[model samples]
Target: MKKFIYFIFGGVTFILGTIGIFLPILPTVPFYLASGFFWVRSSDQAYQFLLSNKWYQQYVTEWLVKRKMTVRQRIQILLILFVLLAIPFIAVPNTWMRLVLGCVFIGHCIFFIFFFDKKRTRQKISSENKIFFR
Candidate 1:
């Protein structure tokens, strides 16, 4: 029963994450992460499929392993965030809401600029070090 529930949730979140690829306002990573979480708990096959997927490899696994994004990736994410938020920032009539949107934009900018792209030293994997797929 628990595994069944997890599988169902994983499927739902995976669909959302896939949809998010085409919809800028809907975030891709979070949904993918959620799907991965459920899949890992429920079905190893599903989790492995996600791990081997090109999109997941490019977007989620790279970030998870490296803890940083390339400049181009960072720029793309920022631009999407800007475009998604800019419309509301401009069209919203409520002053407080506009202020909130502006703040959110600024916050996203700061995070992607300073924090998301931080450089880290890569440790050399020696022959003795085994890389686990899971």
Candidate 2:
């Protein structure tokens, strides 16, 4: 029963993550991470599939493994967040809400820039297997 619940939750999270890929308002990475976590607990097959997914391997696996992201990846994420956050920052009429959004945006920028390690050249990801190693 517990495994069944985890499987259901994992499937829902994975679906939401997939939808998030196209919807800027929805965060893609967190949902995927949560889905992977639940799947690992409930079903190894689901976990393996997610870990092996090309998109996941390209965009998330490196950060998961080494807490690193390429310079390009970092910039891309920042740009996406900027564009997405702009909606609430500009469209929302409430000054306090906009200010809150701005703070969150600033916080995200600071954390991403200051905390994550820069991806090194030696961490070349193999195209076929998507494996990265020093």
Specify the highest-lDDT model's number.
1
Model 1: per-residue lDDT, tens digit, 10-128? Answer: 99998898888888777788999998999999989999988898878876877766565878877788788888877887887889998888899889787666555443223333322
Q: The CA-based lDDT of model 2 is what?
A: 0.79
> Would you list the clashing residue pairs of candidate 2?
none
Candidate 2 off by > 4 Å? 119-134
lDDT of 1: 0.80
Candidate 1 segments exceeding 4 Å error: 120-134
lDDT values, one for every candidate: 0.80, 0.79
| Ten contiguous residues with the weakest lDDT in model 1 | 119-128
